[model samples]
Target chain A: MIKVENLRKEFPLGRTLQKELATKEKIAVAVDNISFQCQPGRIFSLLGPNGAGKTTTMRMLSTIFKPTSGNIEIAGINAVTNSRDARRKIGFLTGSTGLYARLTPNELIKYFADLYEVSDADFKIRKEKLFDLLDMNDFQNKRIGKLSTGMKQKVSICRTMIHDPEVIVFDEPTSGLDVITAENIISLIRDCKNDGKTVIFSSHIMSEVDLLCDDMAIVHKGKLLYNGTMENFRSNQQESSLTAEFIRIIHESNAATV
Target chain B: MILKIFLKELKDTLRDKRTLIMMVVIPVLVFPIVLNLFVTVSSSFEKDAAMQRVKIGFVGDAQSPVIAGFLEMPAAMGKKDLIPYPNEKALLQDVKNDSLQMGIIVPDNYQEKMDSMEAVTCEVYYDATDLGIKDRAKSYMEYVEKSARDKRYKSMNLDETKFQVILTNYNNTASDKEMIGKLAGGILPYIFIAFGFIGCMYPAIDLFTGEKERGTIETLLTTPVSRLQILIGKMCVVALSGLLAATCALVGLYLSIEVFNLVDNEEILSIVRGILTPSFIIMLFLLLFPLTVFFAGVMIPIAVYAKSFKEAQSIITPLNIVMVLPAMIGLLPGIELNYMTACIPVINVVLATKELIAGTLEPVLLLLSFGIMVTLAMIAVFVSYRHFGKETNIVM
Candidate 1:
């Protein structure tokens, strides 16, 4: 399971940023005082519009960015205090994550496996299973730069799942993919949930959240607007559709501030 | 873990055409191409200068003894054709217009000066811009003057040796190796330092800024590795590349001299062969190792701070001049490896290499130079680690 308590991330504003923002503030709060949980065998989605701090929050969870102040627990380890140990238990992937273009899919998989310190026997078994599942055997030996986008995405999936971490974090995993290629990610999320892995993904796509997420949180301007299960969120929605409700919540938050 | 990352980075860097060219191909070819061109051009110039025929114009009676003296001169001085001029003005004009390579105005009654035992001055004119013509004219004048002096001595019944009061002989105590070492030693280190910096530049940018631009750094950071380990691992590859490039340049120099026989001077060839002893190579590498690390250290922070490869390159390219300019100091005359110079970074290496070639380096100064470079390299590495640990610099 992944647990976050009062997580806040602040970035120092440089002179250029201060001028651009027209603010005297020394720091910009990207993720402000947010808290949430992702239980095993469930998909927890963090949903927001663009620039809503979804990526920052996800980065903090994956230990890519250190929080200015807060607590992060990954698989019972204090992620903030022992980030290296916590990282071992976490598998992080993003749509923008780039593979070394000079390397073949097989080489790339082996590299990530070595980084995670997986045993040789376990690596072989996992590689075989993922390759068969993703239909990657045909292109596994080809350079990643030469592979098609769909094939590259499959290699990414194999790389992320090589070490078989307890918690998986996906940040906008389908941001630039076609519908057909995106189905590969959709199926991978379902498989993670079936395998009893704690999964947390951030996206602005309401339909994706509705189809897969068990529990959900809505954040805007770095503030948590809604935190509850999908079932409760649906029952409480006063709008005609989930998209409209998401839009209404953001607009209402802005209106209240004004 | 560091070794694993280093091996991976090495494999990745080897596959990059740009880095490979900078690290190996260019360094290996630079010396041979340059030295061959230099030797060919210089030898051809020498041959052309020897074979050139000069035209001499004179304004004097053809029956004068001076004219006979000129006609009787030996052919070994150089091939020459003499043309008669009516006056000094015409003779000078011919020299100026390139119709004649030189001009001589023998005085009227020139034989009268010889008969009376008085010195007579003859005017000689040639363009200073004509490279070797002035020297050739001086040589011909000296020969003619010696012949006139001999005739006077014989006529007067005086011994030429008794007329000479003193004869002095000059000698040089320094060996050929020492002379070449002092004069040309700066060139070797300058080449090594230049190639070393260039060798480190591309890989430093590619491994750090390229990773960020490609969106791979974020995922790498997510793995179970400390930032320090990653930095050290990549730094090892960068430093190794610099050393490799410098070694390739040395190989190139070896090929030019030994295999290609571009250098034909026996003295210089023997000195070069002596300088390539195994001990000299080990000492050269001893000085270069820390320097390569320092180069890698200074470059990594810039690479980490830059968000793209082009930006890193734009910044580092100018820095190459700043860092390598001091290596040129060794090329200057009268500069030596004193305590102050030994404390300077790139300059110390250059002068130390010079002294090493001359067999005059003191061990204390070598230690001081090496110590200073190591300390600076450590400080630079610490700064790189600090910059790399900063979240704003590492991620875009």
Candidate 2:
């Protein structure tokens, strides 16, 4: 399970940024005070528009960025204070996550496995199972730079799941992918959920969120507009559709601030 | 974990064609190609200069004692053909038109002056631009004058030694190795510094900035390893690349001397071989190791901070000049390793290497230079860590 309480992230404004934003504030808050929990064996969705801080929030959960203030617990380990140990329990993937193009899939997997300190017996069993399930046996030795988009995506999924961590963080994993390639990610998320892993993915696509998430949070401009289970969200929807409701919430928040 | 990262990075770096070219191909081939060209071109020039027969044009009577003396001069001073002219103007014209390589004007009463023991000045002219011609002319004239003086001395019937006074014998106290070291030792460290910086450059940029640009650093950061471990692992590869490049250059130089026979002087060759002893090489590496680390350290922060490979390159490439410029100072004469120079980073390494080659390095100064470089390298590593830890810098 992944737990976040009052998690916030702030980036200092450079002189250029200050001028561009026309603000004298020394810092720009990317993720404001917010709290949510992702239960194991269920999929939770963080929904936001561009610059909505979904990526920043995901980064903090993955221990890539330390929060300004708040607490992140990964599998009962305090992620902020014991980040390295917390990182061991988290599997983070993003649509923009880049693989080492120069390395073969086999080499890349082994490297990450080594980094996570997976035992030899476990690495061999996991590698075999992943390669077979993904149908990656034929091109595992080919350089990733030469792989097709689908092939590379399969390799990335295998890489992320190689350690089989309890918490999986996916930040817009299917953002730029074609439907055929995106299916691989959709299935991987399903597999992680079925394996009883705590999964949280951020996406702007309401259909994807509606299709996969058991619980959801809607955020806009760093603030959480809604946080509840899918059942509660569906029952409380005032708009004609999920997308319309999401748009309505954002518009209402903007109008209220203005 | 650091070892694993180091091995992976090394594998990745070796696979990069740009890093391979900078770290291996160029450094290995540069010395052999340059040395071969220098040797071939210089020897051809020497052969051409030696074989050409100079035409000597004279404006005095052909039977004059001075002309006879010139005719009798040895052939080894370089081959010559004497041509008689009616006057100095015709001789000058021929010399100017390249019909004659030189011109000599012996006075009409040259024999009378010689018989009377009066001073006689023979004017010899040659173009300064015509490389060896002027020296040949001076040598020919000096030979004829010396012979004429000997003849005059014989006629005087006095002891030749009586007029001589204050005979001087100058000697050098330094060894051939020391002389070569002081004069040319700057080149060794300069090569190491140049190649080391270039070698560190590509890997440093590719491993740090390239990782960020390619979007791979984020995944790496999410792994279980500490950031410091990753930094150090990547740093080891960068520093090794620099050392490898410098070593390739040294190997190239060795090939030029041993296999290519670029240097033919037996004495010089012996000195070079002696200077490359195991202890000397170890000492050279001792100076170079921290210097390469320092180079890697200096470049890593920029690489980590840059948003793209091009951005990192634009910043670090100019820094090469700033870093390597101090090594050039060692090429200058009289800039020995001292307290002040020992504290300066690149310059200290250069001068210390020079003194090492000359076998004159003080132990205290070597320690000081090493300590300073190591300290700077640590500071640079710390700066890189700080930049890398910044969320804004590491990710776009």
Off by over 4 Å in 2: A20-22, B54-70, B80-129
How accurate locally is residue B23 in candidate 2, as Cα lDDT from 0 to 100? 99
Please provide, for model 2 over B201-252, each residue's C-alpha lDDT reduced to its tens digit, 9 standing for 90 to 100: 9999999999999999999999999889999999999999999999999999
- The global Cα lDDT (0 to 1) of model 2 is 0.92
TM-score of 2: 0.93
lDDT of 1 by residue, A1-258 (tens): 999999999999999899999999999999999999999999999999888899999889989899999999999999999999999999888999899999899989998899999999999999999999999999999989999889999998999999999999999999899998899999999999999999999998888989999999999989999999999999999999999999999999999989
Clashing pairs in 2: none
lDDT of candidate 2 over A1-258, digit per residue (tens): 988999999999999999999999999999999999999999999998999999999999999899999999999999999999999998988888899999999999999999999999999999999999999999999999999988998998998999989999999999899999998899899999999999999999888998999999988899999999999999989998999999999999999999
Question: Cα lDDT of all candidates, in order?
Answer: 0.92, 0.92
For candidate 2, give the docking quality class from DockQ: high
**Estimated TM-score per prediction?**
0.94, 0.93
